[model samples]
Target: MNSKSEALAAAKKRITDLQSQMTAKILAIAAEVEKLMDVTPEREVRDFLRVTCNLPSSELGTYMGFGRTLKGSEALLQKARVTFPVLKALVAADAETRQEIVERMDIGARIDTKEIAVVRKRLTEAKLTPEALMAQKNVRLVAAAARKRSADTAALFREKLASFALHLRKMNASDLALASLSETVRNDALELREQFTDIFGTSRRSLNKINLNSPAFRVAAANDALKRICEGRFGNSSHYAGVKKWPASDSQIIDVLLLLSGHPVPRRGWVRGRNAITELPPHRYRLKAIELCAGAGGMSIGLERAGFEHVALFEYNADAAATLRQNRPDWNVVEADITKVDFKPYRRMDIDLVAGGVPCQPYSSEGDQLGQEDERDLLLESSRVIAEVKPKMFIIENVEGLLHAKHGDHVAEFLRRVAKAGYQTEINRIRAEDYGVAQERHRILLIGIRRELAGSFRMPPRFPERRSNLGDALLDLMSENGWTGAREWARQRRDCPVFDRQGNLIAHGVLASTVVTRRGTPRTKEAARWGSKGINIGGLPAAAPTDAEASKPGYLPGLTARMRARLQNFPDDWKFHGGKQSVADQIGNAVPARLAQAVGLAAFAAIRGVSFDWEAMLWPGDRGRLQMTTPALYLDQPQLAPGRKKPEQNVRTVESAGDW
Candidate 1:
């Protein structure tokens, strides 16, 4: 018993010592990073830490704040053994509050994140100094009238006015037909409109009159209506007698009004997730999907591997559509203008997902960044399809530029409409290299699921340890045409050290830069990046380096289409149907197959409310074969006799189990 107690005591002491050491190290790093900021650009310093030191950006600010707030207190902090999260709260607190927190720590009081949070909240609510706040013996409830109000009433009211205007635009004549108003209300609205017209100049048609569609008119009308309702100016008047008896067409408008009025409106069409089936339907091959802008079937290939069976693949470009059809003749490839496709017809088909890599030209930096003004922009059209088909979820892929402030209005409107369609949406940024693709391709994923499953979905876990470099990913393809220097070139690439923007080494091997559509001429910076990997970036090569090509004095091999495809994680067996330039464009525009598969698996798990053994399901095993397994509803159900059926069973036994 004494030996066991002594051992436990020693273990506890070691753990405590290690924790203090970690705290000391964290403070040391904070001081050094802060020192760097004095001599270096803030952004560059941040990037160096983020890439080279592997610090998450979310935690960067907290550590940086440590240098400012907790700078001369490293000894006290280490002695207190404060955790990082508690330090974060302290850093955010004011000097007086921080001093109080530190004093408590000095007395050997164990402070935690939640306790600090409560202390901060109490200080805020009481509007007292930290010492005064801590001196209280009993909890005292301050009267609302006596409490200081921190809200900006005018700014809040302006926000309410804007909300009123937006909500009014959502309503049509049918919504207002049964909404009676008193003479006072009508006169107030007219007065408001006159005031607005005076403030904002009238249109040319009528120099003194308000244009109905003008912003001034909408704001005036909405402001008048909202004010009257809030003041109860027409309470119990005949004007509002039939307001509750609105037509069925105004049901949505009613809900919108209830929300704007700060009234509780129960979520419509919300089915409890627990009640939904947790397994694939018995007769279905897999979840049915309709893909839009299916370029070269990259995402389609991934979804297929993730167990999705496409109902249709839509692509307007002829060569790309042809590639899909040629590669998988069994797929239903629809080569037509996606804008004109009638997705309403598929509403009854029970689609589980509507996934697409929407054209990114509208948001990409290489383009004009015209957003909705650009002819190729299909974001709203995608939203329309989601509304019509009402799939359980949807995934729209685009470049990160879509989230730029320049396109804020367009992105916000898209999210608003998607939310109105009974879906909860989130934007996620992911890197292809993090998912085992041999490139630094970053993509923005706009994912939406039915509101009931809002919190159920999570982004796929990253496997940075599984990341591959350019040489390892494409070595065989590089050596395909008997190039003698291929092995040496591959070795150089494999051994190259990758650096961050600040020139700090981040990794041991190089990753390919994002594949681009045009390879004809390389910019100076792009050329430099490729040159560092021992490759020529001028033009696409028709084939891998041959013996004759390698014999040239200064030849640096250019990547072939197959090599580029390999970098994009496309299978070697997959074939393209286009000429050289078109094939390059298709491959460059594709979502990396492995990255897409990871996302698809995450979406699948969320929608089905089932867990996945991600490694077995996604990672290819021996001989490049998938060791995929899916837990089915009828796995343990008794098999029926041949040619026999059971009417009572909800699950039907199949002759063979399906792969994930």
Candidate 2:
């Protein structure tokens, strides 16, 4: 044998022997820990190892976990450790599943971590056992959470105090569909301290004392304040629209309808541009944006319409990445797991906006409603990326239930964090109906402006007109396949008025139900049991077959994938690559492109310091009197407490329509 070959073999043997020895030593320590204390927690052993073995505390969990898994069984743990380093991941699987994985990997002479990792990933993805998912989920949650510091509560108090002080001063006569904000609710800035004390039982002075950092305190305060505003119980006075229902997290939407209530909505006709982003006047400057969680390019597409040039699009889904590539090959689409992708590289770029519609399940009303408690909640991650990118502005969209989650704890934490990070945030609870989408899907939008430009930034208010019906949204798509019933379905649904007065039919085809990601049809297992082969969904209505055999297959009407996608404001020209069910999932998960467009316009105006009379840019018929005839509760920079100095106004700032 050559000298080089002999040296290589010798080195490889050294590595193999050392790895085995280390695994054996770790197993021995773990077994000792287990035997010494019948109930010793892994953390206690971690500390013991830190002192006894000079092991770093950060790495103790791995050795302790290895011990907990196999005690002193060196051969077993040494093999599995290389294959699946995460002990919790292995333990989370059912015993049968774990045994199966071990048996499968036993084929190899040595533990091939790469090969085992692939099998582990496939098994985890296909099974998605809640136990296994949650184990990883918990670790991620801690890593993503904003580190708590002593200053967090102080920042929370200052933010709330400032918001309250400004709101009390701005609350005045405003006509709304539900109720009017009258003089009784409004307070003089100077008188607010005394009045606040007499009213909400806490003086403005004492609001700072309530320990805003306390989760319990923050939740209770938000609940009380929102409840009062929605129920017309603000300032210890009464004018609240008494909405009788369960204490929903977003009942505050009732107050939102009042706060920015605009001219009467045009109800009879269709809202134009329901399926497209409203094109605004061509602006000179094209601001740059970095899109996070850029699924299917919904937000990115909308931002493109809003005149923002995309510098990069970050998305994890391969299918979604393909969709973005298919549509805009020019866009720099980065397909990567967000947690691992380093944002430090883009810090040098002059990014003007950071926008994304993050996962909502963590705070969604439909799920466990875990809010900040859920590891899946990505708001903290978004904030982390935002800090890294340090954009001039950011727009984040989430489920309305976020405002009500954990008694409003999650949202308060979010706002406090934003304020502490030196950004001024404005939240708007928007109903998609008012924004040119057919569905009444309600979402909360949080727009943050860097503190320097905040004085000139104001939330764009709702346009009061209703848009086109569901019939209008999908009429073209349903007919694309030459389905004979398409016209009749749209005709019958459009003509007969349903529960909703205007803007997509609520029940019938007026407005298709919220085009969700999941189809309300049989699952694969259920279909198999029913002896059906390849079932179709969402294509013309299907009526029950008569004994006469008139109701043939495809005769009944259903909402098709294309039609649902249209209702979600995706242009017909853009195609979803996933076949049928996959298409449905994409459509359901997308942020209505049109809704995102409006949000982007708001950001555009905020960054450019312009009055977003952009509402007037909606479809000719749909833009109905785009005016706020009554006083709007939204306060401009001037109306805020005088103690705080306003940031320098930008040259682009407009002097008109300040009410918005």
Candidate 3:
């Protein structure tokens, strides 16, 4: 027994001595890395760490912080190791503050690793002094406030819906008899009209596919009234011929519209992510990124949810760019085409990733399928920027037809070029509904990692079990201002299963078709005329050619710009700037933010060499357990999701899922 005890004691001593030795060795290497500041510093140190110690560039700076703490006084650097984010922040703090933060983590708020990661990243970005850190509680106070305030979103939504009803009623009277409207409705409409004239200097008008007086000063106002009156009635003149039904006269239809408008508090669809990171502060990531073709900032928002810090977002569309710039003023938004921008400035930023949703008209089956022949085809330009930026990774999003475009050579050709630029690339066709989007949007996601880090990349997890229907996605958004017919509207919307042109069920109980750019959205003639600029690029056909709106090859009602953005996974607070059709087009063109989070998380995980638990992510146990993961797709039952593209493309060989 004495000999056994002696052996155990020796073993413990040896472990203790080795731990000290390991810490000392790491400290020594870190010191050497620092000392080489005058000589090819970043490259030499990054290479040594990557090749010898197996640390990627993204993590190299973190270890350097650890070494600095060990050399400094009483900072508890080793304890900080339990949470790397805390370690990261603690290292940045002064010695006394660092120790205080470590102790506070153990006692106060009892923050977990995930929260710590978020807090640390935010603190790092803020770069607060130790004194500021103490006063701010390192932003935990802000997180608590967000959680409390999010509850008020429902009340706010109600207020907005009430205001919406007043406007709709006023717009309804513009074309019909004010005396014909109910006394309560006419009074409310009058007040709203005054407010409208006060804001825009004009009275509202009525509009639809057959209307000629469209694109006036109040097209949104007119269409909104018509939409509220006509929506959920399920009578858009597209029913089967075999069914004999009673049709409402114009006056009777107007009465039903007014009655439905005044029904309940939830007047329009209301959506606040039942489980989503509605804002930042409590959940920010440590990595850096840049986005191209950032329409309405959809992917940018998603990447933010996944914990990335956007360095810049490049977009050429004036209105869509305005929305991004207005909402995220702090972000660096570069308004320019990919070819016009010089990427030399970003070459040394150590950006971890770059994302883009290049225009797909050239490759889409709807148009000429011209592929490389189209002048607007931006594949080469996208590749050039990638080469110049030379980030550790990149993700390119486009319509799924690109997977089968130019007999599939378009994607293959781009892959070869990116490979030549020193990247190991892989492509996958992902269905957006699988990731909780109400619309079944199938997109081709091309992920490219620097060849050296290729081994770390993992195939992004698929969410086939996700089943978000339109009713759940937009119910709360619609339930504003106490509209009485809202519940019934929801019931009918669910009954309205979305089918593709092939007469196949794609998604059930959803509120919108996929958000397409303005040209593809189902806008009434007036709204379309107001939004269309009628210009083509590189000799390609005009994106919005002169069209017959009343017979819009295929038309579906109940999809508004606001609802379209919701279906595209935009948060309620995020606003889209521009006219009705322009906004709709922007929403449609965007990659659903919910789906983008998956790609962002995948790219981030590759850098960190971590595997995600998809099941756990989809189903969480604690309130703060999840920050930005894919939202639950199914509220009650599983439903099939359908993908959408431009009109049937007159395809003799292939067909779209939806029919007009």
Candidate 4:
């Protein structure tokens, strides 16, 4: 062999030897971690590896996971002499696929990470068998041939038209019934028809003759359009239908809805012009938003504080709408059913964000979990708004129960519908306490960004260390009514030990259980839970505990509406509008303002491609005015009070709506 060829072979050998060495070292480290886990606490070992050893968390997880996934297969891996990347990919693969890949390695087949990824995609998307993937004519080759044929300009037009025809034949009255059509559908069809008129130069007089709502007329129009296409014309044979420029509208609600019902959507012909990003109007605010189900203004206040100016806020609840207007007179509050609201006007207005805290009762554990069947469930309607408004990003906050297995299909369909609108989505769960709210409420946020900003968006960082307990959060309000025992009660609550679902110690002080919406007497089990936390849940209190109440034989303070609001992280100045029950519902159902702010800031950062000083933005001194006025309750270290000092005759106090 020539000198160059011989040198190249030598270098290849060196690479293979180095790769084998890396694989062996990775396995050895994984084995050592497994051994150390038996003698040392898992958290200590993990922290040491991260801080001292300086191993990246992602790499550490992969290495440690190897002990569990590839335990008995170490001998086989050594025999194959696989690289670390291939082994890591195998570790991430499903059991059946991983076994197949290992079998290939056992047979001396040379494989790489990219090939493994392709295999995984084929098995998932095309459901190809391991043997089929290994065949001479593999899935990739078949896909390549199909793509090549699809690339032909003439063939592509014919294929799309053929698919459109099939959809027309399947279209039924059920798909076009006016009673079944959403406002989004009607508005989309209207917009598209206008575009269609201008596209073929068909006279408005001719198009106006057709009744869009009538199923028979729609079917006839579809058949005529198909016929004109087959003859190489839109209105005439010489007129090419494929060459017209489509409208630049992003609203595709009608086509997406049709596609969901098994009809093929001709996105290219009708909405190709939508690819152009509409230039937004100059505004004073950093971002423009339209908020749905703007409950009692919790999320609205948070998002507004996070740098969004709402063009409009929609809320079906009369009391909630009143509360929003009562707080921010400048906000355009629309009291209407979201299902009937037409959001297409905002499409061209360049709305940067669309946010909603949709009703959670449909998926709450307290309810039937009817999901899509529940009339209150507006998950799909929210997605429709995302399609209509075509915002840069959207946030949908609901209960954690929305992610349960019972709602898997419903959640999947929701994601798929949003994807059709050119957005990527993810389900993220956040704890209220993690964002500085004292309640133990856990909520699920469905965040979606435009497809182009997929990886740019990320959930905000969590602050577990900053989580406050109920006593520290509500001490001021709890002691407002001359209750002599309030300080001792607060001390007991602050020092309470917390446990996990498994009854293991997890924390020192306890956070309140989710503040439920019911204003009526609590059930037996719920009262017992509150009793253990040194509080009364039997009924909502009219006011904070007084000396008379504390003097009773058995006294445990019940939470007032304002105290509940405090736990929810609502500012003391924010007022509620309604009767006691209605006020309770508003406070209980609303998102914690602090939690919403965290998520909103994260979305703002991603949409605008900017970063924030999290401390300055989230924990500003002005935002903590209410908490600042309250006595500081020790969080971690407990110390003895010098003595029970008498309450000051003229103790300074902050004005609060709770006094009502």
TM-scores of all predicted structures:
0.55, 0.47, 0.45, 0.56
Q: What is the C-alpha lDDT of each candidate?
A: 0.72, 0.57, 0.58, 0.70
- How many clashes would you count in candidate 4? 1
- Arrange candidates by TM-score, descending: 4, 1, 2, 3
Off by over 4 Å in 1: 1-285, 501-504, 623-660
Instruction: Report per-prediction Cα RMSD to one decimal.
Output: 18.1, 23.4, 25.5, 19.5
Q: Native-vs-model 2 lDDT?
A: 0.57
User: Taking the tens digit of each residue's C-alpha lDDT, what string does model 2 give over 1-660?
Assistant: 999999999998898888777666656665665564566554444444443344565655555554445343456557644423434344444445555556654664444445446666667667767887887888777766644532464354445445543444444433331232444333322233333333335423333445332333433444345444534554432333453322232224323222222212221112232232333443335677888888876677678666687767777777887787786655667777778766765667657898998888887655688877787678877877787777888899888776662524345456667767778777767777777677657888878888767666655567655556665666676566555666765676566455545665444334444555654554555334222211234333323223233247544345555566667777666766756656666677788776787777778766764444455443334333332111111122211221243243222321122101
Question: How much does candidate 4 score in TM-score?
Answer: 0.56
lDDT score, candidate 3: 0.58
Q: Highest TM-score: which candidate? A: 4
lDDT of 1 by residue, 1-660 (tens): 699999999999999999998888878888888897889767556655653455777778877778779888888898988778888888988877788788888888889888777777766757876676655422344434233331343334435434544454455654344232445434443554444344344543331254332344444433444444434432323444455422123334344334443544443332223343223223343677889999998899888767686767789999998898787765667788878877887877768899999999899876689999999999999999899988889999999888776676577667768888988887789999988788989999989998766787999888888878888888899898898778888788888887789999888778888887874577788888878777787788888999898888978888889888888888887799989999999998999987898898888878765555666555634323223322221222222112222133233222112222
> For each candidate, how many residue pairs have backbone atoms clashing (under 3 Å)?
0, 19, 40, 1
- What 10-residue stretch in candidate 4 is worst by lDDT? 627-636
Give per-residue lDDT, candidate 2, residue 463.
Answer: 62
For 1-660, candidate 3 gives per-residue lDDT tens digits of: 699999999999897677556545555555676675446445445545553344565667756666556455323333322344444555566665555456665454443455545655665647878788777784788888876775464344335435644444444433334333445544544554444344335544433332221234123433344333333322232322343322223333333333433433212212222332232222223577878888888888778656676667788889988898677655667777778777866776667898988887777655677777888788777888888888889999887666552334445456657878998776667877888777757788778988667677776677655777766676665555344444555566577676689999976565344445535433455344322211011111212222232134332224445666677877667777887667766876888876887787778678744444544433332324223322222222211121211121111111111100
Sort the predicted structures by lDDT, highest score first.
1, 4, 3, 2
